[model samples]
Target: MSTTPTPTPIPTPTPTPSLTLTRPAPTDNPTKPLIILCDGTWCGRETNTRSNIYKLAELFGVRIGARIQSPDGVLYLEGVGLGSSFLDYIFNGITGQDIAQQCITIYEYLVHNYTYPTHEIWLFGLSRGAYLARAVAGMINNCGIVHPLRIAGTNEIDAPQTRLLCETVYNLYRSPYATNAPHAPQSLRFRQTKSWPLIGDEDPADRTAPRFHPPIRFMGLLDTVGSLGMPEYTGGVGLDWPVFYDQHVSTVVANVHHAVSLHDRLFVFQPCLVSRDHARHCRRDWERFGVTRQEWLPGCHYDLGRQRFRFLREFGGGWLESLLASRWFGFASKVIEPNHVLADLALRWMLLAIRAQSTTVNYEVVANIERVIEDVTESIRGRAREPGRTGDGDVYGHVLSYAPFGSLLLDVVRTLRGTRGKVSALYQLFFDLRDRLIPDDNAVVYDFYGFDEDIPGCVGDLARVSERRYPSKSYVKWRLRQ
Candidate 1:
């Protein structure tokens, strides 16, 4: 019997978001594919949280302290980052600074840490992470990724040669402004970080000039909310937040997969909204490659995203929440509010509630949540149809996931309208009622994700988002660009 070839060793790490070097998967094939997954804001790489990115990583058998049996030749590595914590997410989550950092960090980690002469590269992400993945693809397609060893004059920091070279690299990958944006189509920033006359986008096969550009096989994203310079969930805009997410798409990537959420409506959450205009631009970019698939799924932001933290994982799904998921509005409307005492009370109360529940999830309770949904959906629609309502084109259809509970909860505080407490009550009551609901077998399961195969929290392929949902009459918010 022939012996197995030795796995390739990774180079020294200079600065990476997070690098994982492991033995090749248990397979005889020669080509080992590297799959890098990025998590969204507040998506912890640690074991405590339930990030879909991690779930995908686990599927690839790329873990911190475990060996996995993967299909064929596969070596998994993930580049994770968004902000420091769930708090930084409140402000810096989608800033250009953060996106740029993630893009560069991931690129450096991959290009420097590993050399995949014969392996495939796949980029996967959700929410802001998706934006970064697409941005990375754009950079590679335009301003190719360079190896760390290729960064010249590292020994002499003050040298002009070193300064210019470092600035070029930094501006290309991490700068908020790209003065050469006109030449670079992937990123549309007009000041800096833009492409400067085929500087990095040289021929791929060429061995000279610190170059190694791997063709990304696929880009899979879930509800890519490239909010561009939207204000923070808590308050204020990022100093480095790019004014525009821009009209750039990587021309090199082979295929694109985007899972769109039809029902995500929370004001602060709305800024990250991926518009139909952006979708059209993406399609145009991927047109030559002929690999663009976009789908619309039901549920609120959490239903679409499935970002479960410690509190949700232990408690599981509720009438309003699947895996205790809530959008930025949940905290932005509460804990981050200017009120000092109330925020503390809310935090303590939430901790108490989470502590009260056992880690064991109750499926029966989740199954019965449909009753609550039906009640709330019908109730909200009835109120909206009262007078001068767009019966056929109500916003509810677009935000089916969150509108019901959000509307009903709003009714509870209609008496005390405009106060922070009123808004808090709306959000608070929704979660409270969700956790308390019991099962109702009489309720037929509603198909939120239009697929026959049930991938809970939707940790699956974007192509699986379904073809039937494409021509939906409900009018998902993706308007074609003029």
Candidate 2:
């Protein structure tokens, strides 16, 4: 069953934000939307993994404090990074329990301090943080927010004991060991542990700890590696992934954005359980609207987050990781100079292709990306044993540019317009095959988000080959091979 759809609090009567005022707000206005950022393992508040989150916080925090209305209409943003200290990594990073615990803080803030119906919530995270965001969304949709036993006052932070209760609430919704916990039937824990549609004369309007809730506005992620922090010996809490599934959450979110790395190979990082299950559930939600989308780009898990949080590794690096493995391994090192260090193992660790609709950017320029990937991958496979594959051959550089894609799109549309009702299996078959590699419609599309100008020099280049999308899909379609 799907998670219960919690309507976002959009007050019917919106008070005009004093757009002309330049002083600190007298009282926090209900119209303000709260934006929260959760960081990945070992990279929370102190070492925020994504730079964009930090920038957004700094930029918006000032505007809100100064009583100036932001163009985006956001007035508040919360940034939390899990496993910020060394001890936390040693203790809780593996299971990503610390982050789950941290999400309790978000729960309290929304439940007690910002419960107004007008408040909207936006969540952004990277890697482990993304998993936490997904789990939180599912929890909110299914069990609803839990009111704090004791929220900190206007000037104070939550007490340690109160924070613990928040974690207990999240655990009840998603942690591996929450359901069977023994608690008094009258206690908050007892109510929270129960599933959706609370019993008795029930409705969200009922004032209670577990039933108090908030609506989500958006959730955006970057390469959600849910089990990355789990210890390898345990093979991780694999079955527990059902706890973070987003199917039940489809109705609660207005948008879901995911950016993944096509070449990250840490071995420890595993794809989110939700991504594996999307085809059966969330895919339909996405095709009908811009509600769910994930764009795949070249790089590793960390690199995708870097596209927004930090800098790209080579040519133009905005993000920095001290680990040599994260910095120069695999396809990333080939940005400027081809990396022969582990060239033989390139495709062995490739991530699957992605699908998403394009907005605020043009996809026409990248129409031939599929053919380019195929051509380059084949070349690398043929020369896997060469001693210095990255040197002069420049084998991985340059995609075959098949002329301007805009014109090609127009030609396809014109061809299809005339054959609407009649059965054109030949055209349909060709399109079906070609679409697998490159989609003609927005049903599934790949995107390079916020990565236009700073493409790293090591990633190679593109060369225009023909004025066509593909060489008829027959030249290399051993499956559809001419």
Candidate 3:
């Protein structure tokens, strides 16, 4: 002992193991992910009282499995004034103001009072809220440091980390600038930047970047009364986002008719300014990729949020779904694997939660979308019966023959499920979309009992009229039409 002379006691630092917890499975008593709602233009802690905000929360609460369906521990933040440091600097030109930090503070508050069996957090925002969500997400992921915001001189607190299922209203008024105005370069500056929180630069190996960007995706409605494509707004210019993100992300542009049309709207005409291409561009891109534009009808930005469509709100929004679902389950299958069953279920729950939460819906959008689906279905059915068809017997089969068309049709159906309303011009718009999708005259092969005749005169006429605007490109368009 004396020889050993107690070598100056070496203090062995105990390493902290990564934190993990067990909760009831979703089926038995699903743990709800924490729900945080960021405020819109002028929001505050009480935003949950607002119709839109409340609805989003309710829907999210209903979405978590069973245990958390009530969302008692859910925390709501206005995400207004000054919070996210980056946004505070960007919006208020003030440095070190972190709204995201405030978010973390609120989150920590819940942890103290609640069990926090699940780390998955569900974040909802509209317009300005979207920007706040983005900033908060970045801060949480980039810097483990969370800066909680003081609410109306409230006590200091810890913010919670959440999986965001945020939706931005791309309507004229909600955008950075009014839809009818001139395209501003500053509006899209952020989109052009390569760095963003969570979503990183495009991987050269992946080609979807130029279109989908990162976590942010564009969901537009169609209506001559509304703006088309991307509007040049002072803020929320997704075009400023990375061309692609290593984080697997995708975009869905449901073509709801007339309520929020993009057709000849100024934004639609100036695709270059907003980094957006016209329907022709989407069509052309899809054609090149052997896919087609998936056009749905009757729903606008708001309408899509109301209805419980798994594809638009969740399945397609895998970014949000995987984040929330895995938060509690700790299941890598849903987060990492493409087409994982749990992931799909998570998507369904998201849609259900959103639908359950949102009460506001454009009735007109619902009717219009339903009508469009009917029209397309009838249109395809009629085409299938032509005297000189030469392909598959079933209507779906013929549509699937053209992979692009099939994909487009599938998306259209998906949108219809989430939309409402019936604009008079939507049927015409469908024909227009169909025409843009199928440009070749001889390529319209309707194979009914090997007759191999031309497309029906009605479809053919629509195609011809719609073709010149969208000239035939040499791209090898896929023949699938879902």
Candidate 4:
């Protein structure tokens, strides 16, 4: 053995396994961002109606390159506004039972998927859906996000228990005097508690300490109609209910963007306007950064939200419909056609706002959005041209520029006969009276082309009559016939 001293055949020092301490790629991080899109009453993907909310969902999908509800990527949730069915519309929609349920649905989603302070929440909505969005935000403001309950010895979320927790939290949020009174002690306790069993835990020594989960990143609203019932009827039965009225901008919401319809004057469709005082106080941090915006864009609610074209395409029919549908083929020849261009413009403005305010930067989303803006800008420019002016000019000639005047009249009649008949006619009458009585205040009116420095692209020379022209001081003058 001393011979060739196989010298303890020095075991080849097993190369210490080199460990490359590498960080996860940005996409691989456990952080899960959430987006909740709540569509207007009777609107949702199931209905195949492409409202702004629907389009937004599509844009988000494109941006993430994943289907909604994908486990590996962003979690997207949609709350079909109150009326998905006639019965549902009558019972739940009218009474706001649907709104409560929708809030619970969203809250449960948060419980299941929301990661503590790391997750970002973005909400978007139209009409009643906007109310739903605000309500959910308020719930989160009052009752912190509920932690998901997991099954014993497993990673799976306990769905029933999580739902029960969400319901309990919501009840506390909507409790009597919730808005006026100090935060409910139960809700505060919930926020301070660490786990899902939610049994008695040592309360924080400082009871008055503000308790809440991470603030909502952004809330984008289009024509937020807070009324609970049918617009045709008196502004819903529960107009004065605290639940409906309390859906204000909470301090926990970081940024707010509201695009209002300047031309809408329906008494029943009263806007739940963002509280300017509250916005000023809550968004102090973002206001200097110019992140919060509330613009009164040109058009009716349908126009601002871009819901009519798709809706009409789906449900438009009758003698009037046949005629309008016929003329749609010759849309290029008609001047003063439906305010579809205005709708497109409104959509573009919202997209720009989202791009500006979103915390995450997705180059593909930005590029796609830019392309959409360019295309929309070009279409608007082409549409704004006078008849018989250029190759893209109205082929029907200048005299025929007013030819669509009859079509416009027919459209009005058609609208009067449709589901929106009573409401649309009433608003039209009010607006007509308003225009006649109130002197046009150019100073107060917004120029369609008066592009916000933040929002790029020119919208041509269209003038958006200020919503103020209808009600505000002008209304008193009109009432007095001064």
- Name the better of 2 and 3 by TM-score: 2
Compared with the true structure, what per-residue lDDT tens digits does model 1 show for residues 264-356? 444333323222223324333234333455454433344344553222211122333322334533531211111111111112222222222
Residue 405 in candidate 4 has what lDDT? 51
Q: Which stretches of candidate 2 lie over 4 Å from their true place?
A: 1-30, 44-50, 62-97, 148-165, 175-214, 228-248, 273-290, 307-482
TM-score leader: 4
- As a whole number from 0 to 100, the lDDT of residue 68 in candidate 4 is 39
Q: Residue 312 in model 3: shift from native, Å?
A: 33
Please, what is the whole-model Cα lDDT of each candidate in the order they appear?
0.40, 0.40, 0.28, 0.53
Q: What would the TM-scores of all predictions be?
A: 0.46, 0.46, 0.27, 0.62
How do the residues 29-135 of candidate 2 rate in per-residue lDDT, one tens digit apiece? 22445656655554423333323333334433424332324344332232222313433433464466555555665665555544434555667666677776776
lDDT of 3 by residue, 1-482 (tens): 35645568776544332111011112221133345655333232211113234344543443322122434545555434322232232233111134334444543443343321223344554333434443343332232212233335667542321211111111111244443221234323322331121122224365443322112112111111111112222233222211111011111111101111111112111111111232223333322321112121111222212211111112222354335333353332211111111111112223333333223322111123333334433443354344432111112112222322345665665566456444322322222222122333333222212321222233223222122322222122424532
The per-prediction CA RMSD against the true structure, in angstroms, equals 19.6, 18.9, 23.8, 20.2
Evaluate model 4: give its lDDT: 0.53
If ranked by TM-score, best first, what sequence of candidates would result? 4, 1, 2, 3
TM-score of 2: 0.46
Evaluation by TM-score, superior candidate among 1 and 2: 1
Which candidate model has the greater lDDT, 1 or 4? 4
C-alpha displacement of 258 in model 4, angstroms?
0.9
* Each candidate structure's count of clashing pairs: 13, 21, 77, 0
Find the candidate with the highest lDDT and give its number.
Answer: 4
